[model samples]
Target chain A: MSGDTRHGVGVSPGTAVGPVVQVAPPVRPPDDEPAPADAEAATAQIQAALATVAGDLDAQAAANAHAAPILKATAMIARDKGLAKAAAKHVGAGLGPAHAIEAAVAEYAAQFEALGGYFAERVTDLKDVGDRAIAEVLGVPAPGVPSLSGPSVVVAHDLAPAQTAALDRAHVVAIVTEAGGRTSHTAILAAQMGIPAVVQLHGATSLEPGTTVAVDGEAGEVTLDPDMALLEAQRERRERRAAALAGVSGPGATRDGHAVALLANIGGVDDAVAAGAQDVEGVGLFRTEFLYLSATALPSVEEQADVYRKVLEPFGSRRVVVRTLDAGADKPLAFANLGEEENPALGRRGLRLCQAKPELIDSQLAALALAARDTGADVRVMAPMVATAEEAAWFASRVAAAGLPKSGVMIEVPAAALRSRHVLAEVDFGSLGTNDLAQYTMAADRMEGELSDLLDPWQPAVLDVVAAACAGGSETGRPVGVCGESAGDPFLALVLAGLGVSSLSMAPKKVAAVRFALSLHSLEECRALADTARAARSAADAREAVRAAASPELTAVL
Target chain B: MPQRTVTIASSVGLHARPAALFVEAAQGTGLDVEIGRAGEEAVDATSILGVMALGAKHGEEVILTADGDGADAALESLVALLSRDLDAEEG
Candidate 1:
């Protein structure tokens, strides 16, 4: 073998070759740390260490406006008088300074965990603060992403939001994490920043810090000590991919002139503004959860409308398909949480939560209607996690009552996809949320990194589901589109188009490649590729079969 | 001492931004303020850790007491802050 190769989930598309730089995990107090001979001096040291951490975080906050609130809050935690007193109490009880800090942090962490929900989530922020203080007390280097000296592939167990936010983007060429699913913070941030990233790589942090490695983010492969020939090939492919992407622009179309609306999937106003400046037609997925996730109370309709307006104003008359709040399970809103469940994925979430609390959906629909009227944008509202025709009808009636033009439902539940003909009859259109669809179809939890194989969008079963949903859409004369991670994959985009998906929505940066991929194939050729993939025995085989069937020019760049 | 009883209006209760804002406001006041559930042990209102550890939730009742200069004015202002949904306001 030219070099040892490791596999992971390719979250962000691209390639990079650079030396590895491992991010150090949070520091722990030494088990055998001895008690200080002078308790007063120990207490003083503990206080000073916390203050230093607070000061450092404050400085960092001052420099990064995007991360300022988070950093400032962490700094505030460091300077808490209650925390200081707790540590001092531990010091008086004969624990070393570092040990005292750990005990104090654990005390508060236990309280936060006991509180549960949003309070429990704060425990991570608390622990980060504690780790920083402990590092200072022990006179060790701070834990988390270190300052990069040059372009490097950074490896870590899992990157926290704070760590990812603080990364030296200019010098960090690629990211490999031992843990994190496709929807994890690291994966989302990497995709948004357009950096090459591979997640769920086992033993990723074990690579020698200075060892040269080649990261093929598209292939989810990391090769140690890559040979000169492999590196040269990667460099040439990078150039060729760029040139190919540059050559193709404007609205997406097949070689035969079959139209495929390429669009962006955005979460909020900032994402909308950025995506609007790109070459895509308009937003295909507008996730509205960001407004409610952070709020302790539901935002007023006016407040919601203002945010929606900002998101819609960018697209003008272009279509912006908005998905109503998708919460519960992985992302729980404290205000709207439906309590704990053994199986949150299958529990009351998305439209189910909306059904139980009609007021929530009512307010959201009202806001979307208001924003649509004000901005004059072609706004279409969709409900997530709809499992039945009745659910779709119920949502459609509400959408009409709110005066919104078009109503749609996300065909994520297999039941909905199976009966989509009936479901689509009740709505204006449909969109496939392939991520959750695959998760539910394969009986795999999307959050379980170990089950990534089952969650792969290339699985023949998932393709069948997509084809079934498309058949339903065609039967009802309703357009169906894909607004999921799979839509961003160039090869998969063609497959979706072949399955009769009228639109493909992905990250703004990924739109170009998918658009270019479509430009190389005719509708007939895409259908042939789709048929070949669906006939395969396994996900890997399906992918290989499609790759083998695709035009060589198209596959070369990918 | 001036005391006021107010129900937490924030949908998330007295936590996160509300807790931080409440603590900052309490600290800005030159009075010694304490907050707690009725008939429970009170914590320093100016301490963010203590306030967050209180584990207060939306629609829960809290008792605020302050002593020293401008105690009445401080308690009144604090009560006003707690009456609104602080989390709903834009940053």
Candidate 2:
């Protein structure tokens, strides 16, 4: 279609060729004073813009009924009095009705972000309303290339919320954003939708609409204008891999039929509910920090109870292991503000901070206990960064006193793993937070992209920690689960299963792949994978060894 | 005006739960009490946000003050409450 096009990191692995679909950003012409030159005329213009945006949203909702939930949520933002008043303020600030809507929406979004949580979530919805209003005001399509007839990779400079949310999963084979990160909304949503995506490309949007592209999400590389052979190969691989993984279901059981729990690691109560509502076995890890992080002050006991209740309700009687507030200096709280630390990751965090502030721990435990009592959900509470047996006992006792049935500790610290037997001796269960465990064992900063080499869960030392913790778990007659990014990798999941982990908790999208991996190998075969990984000299070697031992189908997914 | 000084007994000092508890206790009293570090201008004790904003540390001395009816008794009770660890009681 045009000269060779190039772009940024290819995160998801796939290939697609499609007609170029150009998505223009929502246009907002500077508001010109209406001919009437009165407040009432400006008001009517704003009203008309809002009505058009609402109608557009209704049309979209009808087209994608499944999007009703998010759309309804956005409508509330569109109708928010705060947003309306703020827009009116912008008019007084000397902006036209169109520009005023943008200004007001942006202001409200910023304020909501400052408030955080239920309010912060409104930011996305507000932005959506603003985008639609601006688009309607300018009589432009709502900033997205829609209705692609064939499977294609979507390319963009930096996708806005409306653009990303509007993506049709059926037509979008992959996503390549020129500017974004792993934590960016586009990447996260793409991952959620199970669409391969790469971000942080230099010239993603410059590619002609409807061009052939190949993306390797795992390798984080993109090849623009790929030759026909490479495109075909990627397409074939994607199909075969998707088919193979789809064939797997049920629990993550060993080849010999030892049932290993396949769980989901969720970020918040909503995620926990959504993941737990699935046919999957249970939730291996539910991160509770989101509630605290989303609030400017500590969430009240009642507020925490409501969130915990929702998270536990979906799983019903299934096990839902909740990790208590794991925040610290790195992700400090507004109220529990720990002053700036030189090395936040290694500084006060997880159980260490809990120990210092037992009251905070007590309130959390009390809330969990109250929620458990109300829900009657099979729940277990755990603390993160537990190092000593005393810490484990301290946390366990507190949890028990709060009326919770069981208490567990996350074996992420090297010391805890090395002495897991003693640590597990004090708790009802142990779950390996391998991401942090690997980071700590290798003494690598997780935020350092360059140190990604050392942070691999396959690292020999990291595997040793898993094995040791599993061993400790075995000694205590308590089960342990691996809940980290590694658990999603089929090969690494197999290795963990081989090492005696009773559960693998990861993203919901990765469940099928792990289940397939576990089914392909017998306990002996998986044990061999773990042993080989243990014998490997480096993280890369360990990964290679695991890859060599696993089925090609599973290895490809990895 | 009545005033008394007491150490921040809670391990995390006067932040989060302890601060919330202090604010609650102050609310229970019908007085316009102000809490502040000794020698520092006191702030409204009824304001949990304000008391937490003080960020008083463990072993730090904070003065409680109030005016009018029952102010003396309210200050005395608050001083006693702040001198012992509430977390220990709960534990």
Candidate 3:
């Protein structure tokens, strides 16, 4: 075996070892490639290419009505006069139509990419035009995932969202890319699909196709033609970890028997059902954003209640902590949009947005109450972005008035964390949304990949804030759960338990690892670990300190 | 020159389906049309990127201008288009 190794940032957990098959980037037209000399013929050539691409897209739009808006929009781009005129100008200048088309599209692509956000998303649509047009002119099959014959690790420079969507999960065991970060589409998709992926690998694309490769998503290691001993070691380690997790289930607790409930953080019915199938104790945080985000209409109490019932039906008697409609400027409800806001993060969002439209808040509360009654699930209601004791009291009253079993408030805003004891006095429980809490406390937008350092959950400041919220839970004798994206990490779950978090709620797939991690450490050990973490000066250092002091077996699995 | 000043009525205002549909309608007019936010430089209406780049929000005023034989007709058509909630219309 040709033993070789490389490292990159691993965005998803687990390990994968298979033959490497590189997914080639879309073919680019040569920059200096000359166009046809005859201006009239070149014009017709460009016109024909555009027409074919537009027709193909139109057909695609028809075939995929759900995607018609985006596909048809791209088709319109193919027919836009600006592109045709730009191509014609180049043809007139003695450049071939291909060169002209490339240049023309580049201009629009550059503009769209620069606009960022919404316009930036449209860059893919524009570039889709270029790729299809270029493919038509070149007579090459449209660049996309090539049919694979067997399980293989697909390596690439970068996979466009379309290409990623087209990827055959049956054939690709893992994705290795040269240019992507944790926040990139590839990483996000990989996480969603529960695939092990290593991104930003420097020479990922250069790996020869069909070479046996092994990827450790946790370690972010890529090994080419690995020796059998190394492969066996990875297999045995994985088996050991799986076996340990398999030995334990039910509510999470430590070796010394201090109770820690391992719960699921669900978004909608699908998540609830999937998590219900796992060994989780109950739903700790049920995000109600999907109810509002899914459609244009402000759902009626009956419609909302019906969906909540479906989600709660899966859990039966298990507790489902349902968060009220959390529509914000970022995730705007078509019917309840407050128009454009310059600072959406700081502006009307979550509880504030719902407050702006009391009907939205009222109907959602009524739905949760009715759904809880219909499904007979142990339901607890919560409000997101509650920054003050008054807001908490208001949310609790609404939940109580609706006949909900209990009430809670999310600790996302820094203000909520600082005065959490007072806020907790008003609600039945408090859950730390570490993702948003990290963002607000660190003064960094979690969406911005460049600011990931400050948004790291392990950051001492973020942990300190979480500890403060948990302290509130103690003062009020209400359970505090970690329901952010961070709770999924086994190490972070341990740290959360150490900080007095009563429940660990995360994606269901992560429950096993966290459950096993909890069994390896006692509550006292967790507190000591948290103390070591809080004393650390940096996120990386805190993680290392915790890992250094953690049980040897636990650290190995982590 | 024939022109019209109209407020954007689409809920999302000149973006996504609304923006693309707006551009397609403008292209159908044949007569060259330019659109811009009030007091801002107008750009070619036929270009979706250019139109969306205007970032015209709901209830915000935008200026649409066109020239030639059907210039007034073009402006009228565009004004009518912007005055409706294009997003609610069936695709």
Candidate 4:
């Protein structure tokens, strides 16, 4: 602690000490640029700059398969003949090369924004291309994450999805952002990649590059210029944590043998393969949105089944809980978009979106059914954003019609959690998506990093909601599970289990720590800890109380 | 000169991946090709930005015209590409 400490929200767990690498914000064209001496030379420079940006993006696309299509499309925009002509016209009118490029991008951006929906989202991509070309023309470093030379901490105002996708996983040890909530793309990507990450860290981008900083992801603290002793202590704790995690394996349970199924929350085939190879029980949340997110049209049933089969085949005879397409205004599909909405979070999303386009859900269910027939894995289907028994029943009926074995609903809405018994009766099981549950419970936007205090999972109101949902599951004799970022928190896992959640699903990297926590407490101890947390007045108090009540061994490494 | 009129089949219309693919194919043809809605001004089909600016929605009819060598064959190929859902294919 012999250094200045800055606090933020910890979205991923780990510890690292590395030199800071500040991500430069998008560059803007200087307003006072003199007209080029020769218009012909200026136009040539603009074309050359755009071509260089396109060439760089083409190389990036060739290197990363996951971001290939996006990068390639962006490259196409960079090499666009129309855009070049527009810039040339501007340069002919005596505008500088950089200014000309900016004007040209702005024109297209305005058109795209006017179109709205999927087109509006592309404006970011278009503007990103503009920034790169401008930087090239002005002879400055490009915006976004630069190539890492060693293990370093990446500090940024916020990372765009394309920037996060292009991260060098091997060299980047930690991620710190000045803005983002727990469910933001940066948080989710860092957690998925098992990198130490902290978000909402004030003045994070102001940290000098090459200055050493020690980041404690669990504590959400960054210590600038830490002493040797503190660094040594962090290294020891990391090693001890790894050793302890390696000591535990197999199914998750309490010391007294109260069985709690530990599972993985996976998005695609790659995650499935990686998590399946880990020592977890099975997949608790198989998010099906990835299959549709990148596509311009709904995938054919066979195409979806092929992907589903590949995901399922890794876990033989193990349960794979598949959540159907959860797209809405917030994460709109290109083809299934229900137009624009003023409030996407509260609008037609999840079950509501499915209801609007029955064909979308039907095809997904049909594909899951077909894939289940092909694989040995036990697959169950669920719908997200379900708020009532009627919605649950409607989804269950659709699942049955599709010939799926079991059906379930995500208990995210506070209304659904409060009346879980009735909802559970209509479905086989339920999983609490605590992230969305917290958002809806607090009536706070999950994307707003400044309001993260209200969205904390440890909040008494959110816990009470989870308890209500779990109570419904118990009353109906159906198992309820938690499959959210909260589930990955080792301490919070104890509180959830105490609330009678039968299962916990999280990033596979987090399973060992949670399993270790569960092993340190009996069912009674966990229940008592839950009671203590519920009795606390605030989220911070509840967290502190639970930490104080937990086993010393669990608290030591944490 | 040769031309054909066809409806866009990609559910998301002529934007994103479909627009990129169409533009790439049009450029590959090395013919002067143009696309637009009936009774509307046409744009260079080889320009990705121009094709996207058309804002063609799914199932909307768009006329395609091509001139020079192998114009008919290129128009026929372009029409066939537009008839099927190009977005549905695996990238």
Best by DockQ: 1
1 against 3, candidate with superior DockQ:
1
Q: Which residue runs of candidate 2 sit more than 4 Å off their true CA positions? A: A1-173, A176-190, A198-210, A216-223, A226-239, A553-558, B1-91
lDDT of 3 at B78: 86
Q: Which whole-number lDDT from 0 to 100 does residue A281 have in model 3?
A: 88
Model 2 error, position A225 (Å): 3.4
For all candidates in order, the CA lDDT equals 0.90, 0.74, 0.81, 0.90
- DockQ score for model 3: 0.23
Can you write out model 3's per-residue Cα lDDT over A344-423, one digit (the tens) per residue?
A: 88989988987788888888889888888887889988899999999999888878888887899999998998898899
Using all chains and alpha carbons, the TM-scores for the candidates as numbered come to 0.89, 0.63, 0.76, 0.89
Task: Give the docking tier of candidate 2.
Answer: incorrect
Error of 1 at A88 (Å): 4.5
Ten residues in a row with the worst lDDT in model 3 chain A?
Answer: A112-121
Q: Chain B TM-score, candidate 2? A: 0.91
What would the per-residue lDDT of candidate 2 be over residues A72-187, giving only the tens digit for each residue?
Answer: 54554454444566667777666777788887776655655654333445466667688877776666676565545677777776666666665667777777776665435565
Which scores better on DockQ, 2 or 3? 3
lDDT tens digits, residues A324-406, model 4?
99999888887888988999999999999999999999999999999999886799999999999999999999999999999
On the 0 to 100 scale, the lDDT of residue A166 in model 2 is 59
